[model samples]
Target chain A: MEGLSQGEVIYIIVLGSLGMFLFIAGFAVFISMYQKRMLQEQEKRRIIELDYQQQMIQSQIDSQETERKRIAADLHDSIGSLLWAAKLNIAYLGRLSNFNGEMKDSYLETMKILDQSIDSVKRISWELTPEAFHNTGLSSSIMELCSRLNGKGQVIVFKEKGNQLFWKDDRALMAFRIVQELLNNAVKHAKANSILVNLNWNSNRLLIEVQDDGIGFTLNDKIRNGVGWWNIMHRSKMIDAAIEVKQNHQQGSAIELTVPLSS
Target chain B: MNKLKVYIADDHTFVRKGMIRLLNTFDRIGEVKEAANGNELIALVKKTIPDLVVLDLEMPEKNGFDTSKHLIDHYPEVGILILTMHTEEVFILNLIELGVHGFLNKSAEPEEVERALYAVADNDFYRNEIVNHALRSGVRRSTEASSAKLSPRELEILLLICKELTPHEVSTRLQISEKTFFNHRSNILGKIGARGNVGLVKYAYQNHLLELSA
Candidate 1:
């Protein structure tokens, strides 16, 4: 290894330094490309969440439309048929006025029962409407719904906090809807003994609570097939409200929703 | 015979028609009118006086509360029975104040409907499960509002007493004298404005503090 000229040595060292610099710059470009890919992935996830919300809403609309049809069918098939039979039977009973007092009373009672059953089935259909708020206020409508639910299995109790209530048509409609959706969910699934609904209005916010004493969801798991819950959250979002649900310290679960009043 | 004349208001034609059939079965039931909406119910009610008005909460036009309020204001003699599926506590409390005498679930048995109609038609006051629940909630709420007034020791003693603890037992448990326990009990009664021990228990029950031991 003979010594090289000083200029040649300087040129070699400079070229080596340039090569090292190029390697680092190439690595940095690859890292930047990787970061861009990750950002695209994140954006894709956000779009998917939004799409899920839309789909959930569409499915709810579809289900409600379908429910109206099925309820109509139930009335026509089950209750309607029963009433027609009872009406025809009443005519038959009228022909025999000479029957004993006990038999007459029994027939009359049966007819009354059948008639009322027919009414029950039909009224169920009428209750499931978004227009109830415009007709009554949201507060009254919720109470009426809760009382009606008392017939099923569980006892539903409603309570309001404070003397005043704050709701515009849109917020009232949202509150009504969320409450209805929660009750529907309970009826369909929550095999509970009782449900408690609390509607509170403070100066700053309107809070709605739907709770039940039943088999609650696990801490780790999302509520299974909770389309209505998602719809409620989406509506809450639309109004810039916050929503939270948790398995209460008691046996059941509670849903807490807060909608800002002035904000 | 009271000869109670009732008006059944529901949007669905079948419900109104069906209830009419049931009411007609009773010999005392006279002048049964059918209404498909709140507007029709209120209008007809104005024309022909009804002894008992059965209103639906969910209607396309005015709802049961609105119609009932109008009827109550115009004619206090007319007893209003709200018929609907909703049982939220706030709704019950709100309507109860509006002179609604009875609340019946749509799914109630025919016998129950008959009983409710008759009871409200003639009652000191109609208190059903839904209304009772709402009232209990109300009482508890008021107690919570007044919680600030009670001293910490008094609140603790009241909570213990609400657990159905005997005065002697409380004295032993709290390591206080029997006279001291009695004094604390009296103080609780005074603060709650209860007449006596039984009244205090009722207060505790209504406030939902009675079942704390459970």
Candidate 2:
């Protein structure tokens, strides 16, 4: 300390301060870079989880559809056939000449019950999985659905315009299911008296508009958390369709789905 | 008239037995045979061709579609009556195109079944309300050519055919001989490029020649 000059001391001090400032700056850069890397890894994991969730939902829906088809086939093939056979046997018994008036009346009543059972089975089977969907495509199936639902209190009017194009079976089924859910919601939840389902087919896309004359609903937590709505949302996502919900001013609500046609 | 030989094909034993029993009650039906599936039905048919074959659509060995096709191609004279649970228009239309003589729902009353069987046996084609409704709504227009080359009389016959009227009825209604009706029918088929009655009904609907009514 006694041998050092003033200029040398000043130089050493300046050099030491410069080295300190460089060390602090380098440390700051390293900390920021580490945080950025951690954040990127977290984001990647989140995306993977989301993809897994989507796959799970998709499989769930597919399994449900398979189950429904199986049940429908069983109902149609087994129960329906059995009921028809019973009705025939009853009819055969009625043709016999040994029956008294009371027995004949009982036979008639039995026949009527059998007929109603047969009808109920047909309706239930049809509702479970529309067999027409496989043979006639989406339009005819939707028309049939509308007609089936029309006379039972609520009047569902289905209007289709433009040339109908062919669709992939799975995608078409999804669309059909979505429309079915919407109609169900309108009837059961919204208590709609009249509903209009318009399918406007364009060259590249299909625009579906479902409007109902019922109590309108808000996009609240209850609806968002509902299984039906959740299913609709997930199905729309699967089909890559854009969905828009609009509440009418006076009454009811309208849902518009824009579905891209690949074929 | 000779008694009609009938064949019943169904996977369910009860259904087949019930159907046989019901047919037995009818004095017109004779030699009622039974088969478990479409293949069995075909083999039985090969031995002795029945006047009418009642087929269930869903079967184990072969489906009704293939069986009916084979029968229509091989034994064109044998009447193919589809007596299944399917009441879809598409099924009806497809079977009709395949030249099935009749369509009857499994839930149809035994009387209706008898009527369908007799109709198919006598007239060669049985037209029920289901078939009529399917013809009206299921057939779609194929071409933009609105001009169907047909005389007014041919058009009238075509409409009657679409209305589920048999050849005899159409002839009687139009005050024409059966021979004249056949000639007109042939002319209509040629003009519209149709193969059979199903084709004629389809053409009538496609050309908007037949009005859509209940």
Candidate 3:
């Protein structure tokens, strides 16, 4: 050591300092990379959690729909048959003509009431889950709905202008449900005298417009009234569709949904 | 008055009771036998062949499909009238293929039931408007499938059945023995893949043997 020159010592010190600087820089890069990996893992976990939540929501909705369908079928098959049989029995008695004047009058009146009851049962079951919707597809189901509403003194008009559109069963069901909700809101809240529905399909997309000429709710009112809005928004998101509800006191309420199609 | 014996096959007891009461009121209806399910009805029917059988499709033990098949295969003489709650066109069409004498909704008036009973007893097909509409639509949907060709004799028998002629009437009209007429009807039913006379009519409709416009 004593024999080493001063210049050699200076060179050794410089080399050592350079090595130390390089090690520190490498260590910093390693730490940064590790932190970045952890952030990515956390992001992935959050996405998976959101996906699980969406699946849960979808299953809940599916189970509810299944229950509604089962109940509707039960009502139609069991109670509906019984009512029909009762109606027939009464009709038979009325034919016998053995009843006196007052008795015959009561019998006729009973027949009328039974008829109404049967119709009511049919309507309730249909509203729960329409078998017609499944059998005939969306357009005819909607037409049937409008006709029933019209029969009951509500003027609901349906218009379709374009090529006939076909949709998968589940998608059609969801769309039908959305329309039903909108019409219900119009009937219950807007107190609308008339409702207009338009369904149009073009080359790449389908558009649905439902406009009511009744008391309308503004954007603020919609935000405040959260009962059915949440359902509509959730369903819209589920189908990868967009919905816009516009309303004002003077202009009435209007809702439009735009859906993209693969075909 | 032709006193006709009728058998009722339904899962619901109330429906059975109501039908029995209505049948009792009809002067032409003699005995109204009640069975809870198709199996019970089959057993009772084997013992005593009723002039007509009223069946509901969704019965327990044996459904309307199997029951109708059994009846047609064993006792083809008994007329079958289906009274069901289902408004499905497919179900009605399938039953027609089973060769039911008539198809009526459970909601039909007692008068309709009486009419159907008399119609079947008279060896004629009895279908209300609902059944007709359903079958007409079925024909339109299934016009693509062709049926086996019928001989002139078989075609004559089919037309007579469509006219609601009984086997005896058909035999008398053609001056053939009842047994021979039965053999012809069976052969035709097999050739056309029909379960009974109702299926024969449906076949006639599908092959344009019967005019849809008419």
Candidate 4:
């Protein structure tokens, strides 16, 4: 080392420094590249898990809907028919002569009771699966729902703007269910007095705004983790819709849903 | 004043039997025949046309809607009445447009059924509260822009029907025979491209033809 020339020594030092610098830079790049690959793998797995969850939820909803439809049909077709037959037979008996006043009164009372039961059956079947939802599209079905829900102190008003668009049955059903859920929550939980459901049709999307005057919800953990909230979120996700929850200024809550119609 | 022959069709044998028994009690209804479904009803109608054909909407083989359409196209003179558990306004409106004579809820009292039968038999159409409310509130499906316009008489008939007046009452008030009134009604339905009473009411409401009393 003492016999080495100064130029050679400086050159050796510079070469060593250059090699060290390159090694550090290479190490940094390799570490970063490895992290990038790990992140990509993690993201892929997350997406797969999300898709599997979505599929599971979808099938569950489908089966539930099918069950609801079947039950509604059974109630309407079987029980309702039997009740009608019984009512007719009772009516025929009433038409026959030689009944005492007491017997006549009892017959009338029985007929009245039968009538009430028939009404209850009709109401139950309708609630399970609205026949209007299948016959008419979402708009009229919602209108009918609003009318049905309007009379008992709580007033629900449905308004539409712009031209109505035709939606696929499944998608329309989801949207209807979401709206129904919102309305139910408003009536049952929020105890809203007056609710307004406005549907705005845009070129590529339908915007639904449900505003109510009731006890508004706080974004607390209870509400955030609620089953109703969970259902609304998952349903909106299934339809590829965007939902916004807004706490109203004075009272009540407002939910806005934007449903894309392109699909 | 001949006995009004009726044909009743239902999938449930008990319901059909009960209905027939109740109908038998009515002085107006006679020679009541029964069918298990819409197809059987159609075959029965082919054998001998009845004054009125009572239909249950949901049935095996052929449904009420198709059967009604066939009857409307083939036997225009036969009065069709729908008696089903389905009391939805949409169903009522659709059946009316298909030219059904009347619509009755399955839960309706025997007396109401008798009245509906007599109404259909007498006036060719029944205007119950259900039909009226449905017509007044329902939104019409946007049909093609019809260039055909309603004449003065047809417009008058449309307004009267929208006012909840029955066909018999409207004809009597207008000093026309029931046949002439029905012809005008069919013509009005055709001119406006309306389905039936529903279309007429919707058109009347949309065009501000009827004065809605609060």
lDDT of 2 by residue, B28-109 (tens): 9988999999899999999999999999998888989999998888897898889888888878887776778778887888
**What would the TM-score be for candidate 4 when compared with the true structure?**
0.80
Off by over 4 Å in 4: A1-35, A97-105, A159-169, A198-207, A211-226, A248-252, A258-263, B137-146, B149-214
Q: Please write out the lDDT profile of model 3 over residues B1-214, one tens digit for every residue.
A: 6689999998877778778877888879998899988899999997999999999887778988789889978998898888876655666776776677788776666778888888877764775676666668677667387648889998998888877777788899999999998899889988988876667778887777776443
TM-score of chain B of 3: 0.81
Tens-digit lDDT track for model 2 on A1-263? Answer: 47889999999999999999999999999999999999999999999999999999999999989999999999999999999889888888777556779987898899889988988888889988997786677887788888888877799999999988755388998998899888888877777899999999999889998999888655663366487888789999999999998665348889999998873
Give the worst 10-residue stretch by lDDT in candidate 1 chain B: B140-149
Lowest lDDT 10-residue stretch of candidate 2 chain A: A216-225
Which regions of candidate 3 deviate over 4 angstroms?
Answer: A1-27, A88-97, A132-136, A155-168, A186-263, B143-214
Single out the weakest 10-residue window by summed lDDT for candidate 4 chain A.
A216-225
Report RMSD (Å) for each prediction in the order shown. Answer: 15.3, 3.6, 5.1, 4.7
Error of 3 at A90 (Å): 4.0
- lDDT-better candidate, 1 vs 4: 4
Q: In model 4, what lDDT does residue A14 have?
A: 100
Q: Model 2, B7: alpha-carbon shift in Å?
A: 0.7
TM-score of 2: 0.86
User: What's each prediction's TM-score?
Assistant: 0.45, 0.86, 0.77, 0.80
Go through the candidates in order and give each one's DockQ: 0.03, 0.61, 0.29, 0.59
In terms of lDDT, the poorest run of 10 residues in model 4 chain B is B137-146
